[model samples]
Target chain A: MSVLVFSSLLFAASVAAGLLGAMTGLGGGVVIVPVLALLFKVDIRYAIGASLVSVIATSSGAAIAYVREGLSNIRVGMFLEVATTLGAVLGAYLAAKISGHWIAIIFGVVLLYSAISSFRSNVDHLVPIQPGTLASKLELTGRYTTADGTHAYSAERVPFGFGLMFGAGTLSGLLGIGSGAVKVLAMDQVMRLPFKVSTTTSNFMIGVTAAASAGIYLSRGYIDPTIALSVMLGVLCGSLLGTRVLVKARVSMLKQVFALVVVVLGIEMIYSGITGRI
Target chain B: MRRPSDHELELSVAGMLRFGVTAAAVVSIFGGLLYLRQPHASITRFQKFNAGGPGLRTISGIWHGMVHLDPRSMIQFGLVLLIATPVARVVFCVIGFARQKDRLYVLVSSIVLLVLLYSLGHGFQ
Candidate 1:
């Protein structure tokens, strides 16, 4: 296939990936990596490089809407970024040492984990509690709007949340995923922020975390503009369109279907990685 | 310094993000088309990782490439802009916090900014 034909195919696949990712809230980068590495036969490094660019595009694009809606907490997002950005830099440093095979295996495992977790619905009943000393000192408490009204919440377990963010950032840099699953886990589970706050705040931080590593990747010559350009454009277009469809469509059922697809893809990736087919 | 209200800050942040993504996408799409317009000697190898030439590996090289209207360099510049968007957000927040006399957050935002600058500086080395 010629370069033009190949780029067209990639653009189509990324559009689908972005749509499903936005509809299901799983993120386009997760779907992008497996499809590129498995179906398109792209090198893992290049696939990762391309997917990271899309992750930034979709994330920043969606985050604009989220911030404008007053869903994302800028203070919390900024505070937590110090941890995530550091972790991203460290993770990028490590990626150069690890071979592509290990990356594939790790990516497969992370996909399966994300698939299983997506099977469970998000817990919405956040028990309000006073934030810990560190959180209180940093003034991380904030309010978010819900259907009921403006709800106030405070962060807890600041160290734990920060630590989780480090891990999230590392995985993002290593696997070229947005690592939204881990970011949400840190904010929603460990930090004790409300679900809305956690989701939007995670979205707010994703671009910054990806950027930290993206700079490193660019310097290392992993990012190919030709591949990255198609991906960035495709995912941005898809996610924007997905947001429009979201209001009209019930996405619960779509999430389950997409979750199953994720599992199947994860298994294939693992199998391929073990067999050296990738 | 006159402190911007939270509402104003939020608007600025959103505006920055929106502009960054749109500008990057437009530039990337243009570069992509320019790239596709060129003939390929072989099917572009998707399976092998190609470390592109020095045109994008260093800041000086990217600047030179931009002057020459290189498609790859333009795409790289777009990507750089995308990365810088968040960094710009952090800078704005620092200014906002400092203006508000919120010393703690100004300190926190400063640390994030420093980390970003450090990584970028290292990237150039």
Candidate 2:
């Protein structure tokens, strides 16, 4: 295939990845990366670099709407970013050291994990709790609006959540994924934030974490400008369109289908990794 | 002197993010089109792993080439901008926090910004 054909095909795939990602809340990087590596025959490093760059674009773009809706907690997002950003830098540094096979396997494992988590998604029930002293000191408590009324929430385990954020950031940088599931796990399960608050706050931090990785990726020359441009633009456009359709569209079914697709992709990634085909 | 309210601060942060992503996307799309128009746009050589050329490596190099309307450099600049979006958000938050006399958050935000800036430093030289 020629560069034009490759770019056009990659862009189309990225659009579908982004759209499906937004609808299912799994994220574009997960789908796009495997497609790039497995199908497009792109090197794993460049595939991830492109995926990481697009992660920032879509996350940042979507975050605006989340912030404007007052669903995202800026205080929580900013505070936790300290850990995530540092982890991202560390992950990016490690990405350069690791071989392509290892990267592919790790990404595959993460994909499977995300698929399983999505299968059991939205199980968290919000229970009001007194935030830890550290959380209270940082004023990491707030309320979010629902159709009925506003519901108040607070962070429970500030330190644990911070640690988990570090892991999330590491996965993001390592695999060039948004790692939203991990972020949600930290915030919703461990930190005891409201579900809406957790998801939006994770969204809020995704870009920053990805940016940290993307910066390192770009400097390392992992980011190819042509591929990154196509992926970024496609994902951005697709996610934006996804958000619009999300309100009126039925997604529970879509989520299940997408999860199954992710499972197949996950297995493929691992197979490719083990066979040294990627 | 009045401080910006929380909602207002969030709005400012959102505005910064929106602007950064939009600007980055616009610049990237233009550059990508230019790139596609090149005669060699039909060649596909991504099958192997190469770190790429120095012309597209450093921040300064990308800027130097971008001035000459180098298509690849323009795309790199846009990617740089996209990477910088979250950094800009952190910076905006720092200002927002400082204005609110929220020293703790200002400190926290600054730390995040520092990490982002440090990562960016990798692209400098």
Candidate 3:
């Protein structure tokens, strides 16, 4: 295909991914990277580089809205950031040494795991557990209102969550995806935050995580200006539109659909990675 | 009832400008280095500078140094400063609104400004 045609297709695919991602609480990075690598024949490194930029764009775009709406737990995000940012830096450094195939395989496995987890899980509406020690001292717990009503939540297991965030950050840097699935898992399972709070707070935290590695990637020459700029701009616009749709979206159905889609993509990635085609 | 002095406003504006300028400067400086070292084949060169590849290094060096930072770090920083100016304006507005004990306007305006800023920063750019 001509470069213009190829770019346009990528742009449309990114927008679709952003739309699905926003609606279902998944990050666009997961969907974009594999598609670029497998279908478009883009190099995994370049795809990853572009994915990281889009992650930043989506998170920054979504964060502003979530924060202002008082849905995001800013303190939770801030506390967790220490872990994710450090992990991202380490991950970016590690990514330089790792093979593209290994990275692709890992990404595929994680995507599959997240899809299954999404399908099996239930959205808990319980009040979140309070933060202990320094976390509590920092005033990290807060409440947010959903369509149903106002629900208060708290954060716990600060050390564990932070540690997990570091791992998530590493994966994010390595795979060029937002690592939101891992962040949500850390916040929801380890920290025991409610789904809403965990998801929103994860969204709030992704930008910083992405930014840390983005600098590394930029210096490493992975980021293509045209590709990065186009994907970022496209995802940002799509996400803004998606956020509006999110307010009115039937999230349960969206989650199921998203999970199914991710499973397919994950399988495709695995196949391509093993075949040495991606 | 007291108000923030003009000096306070100046200080706040200056602080925002400083931060924006600093971030842009850092990006530009690294961007320049990436541009300068694009032709080299050394992995250490790529590692030290953090260039992803030759193409990225070339582009960032050109884009950031010329379009984004040509005038100076201060100029690039000014763009950030400009982006944040409304935030400072709104904080003062809210403070003034609060002083009048008209809490409603402050709440409404704060949310409005937050949404506006969020959209502008995230959407068009």
Docking class of 3: incorrect
Q: Candidate 2's C-alpha lDDT?
A: 0.86
- Deviating ranges (above 4 Å) for candidate 2: A121-132, B41-44
Error of 2 at A33 (Å): 0.9
DockQ of each: 0.72, 0.80, 0.08
Off by over 4 Å in 3: A120-134, A144-153, A251-254, B1-55, B58-60, B63-125
Question: Can you write out model 2's per-residue Cα lDDT over B1-125, one digit (the tens) per residue?
Answer: 79998888888878878888889888988998898888773335677878877788899999999999999999999999888888888888999999999999989999888888888888897
Q: Which candidate ranks first by DockQ, i.e. highest?
A: 2
Between candidates 1 and 2, name the one with more favorable DockQ. 2
Cα lDDT of model 2 by residue, A109-218, tens digit: 99999988876646544556464577778888887778888777778878999999999999889989889989999998898888778889888888889988887888
lDDT of 3 by residue, B8-116 (tens): 4334433543354345335534443444334433322211224333323433343454554342222222223223333443455466556656555466446534433
Error of 1 at B90 (Å): 1.2
Model 3 scores a TM of: 0.70
* Candidate 1, TM-score of its B chain: 0.87
Candidate 2 vs. truth: CA RMSD?
1.5
Lowest lDDT block of 10, candidate 2 chain A: A123-132
On the 0 to 100 scale, the lDDT of residue A67 in model 3 is 47
Q: What lDDT score is found at residue A75 in candidate 2?
A: 94
TM-score of chain B of each: 0.87, 0.92, 0.40
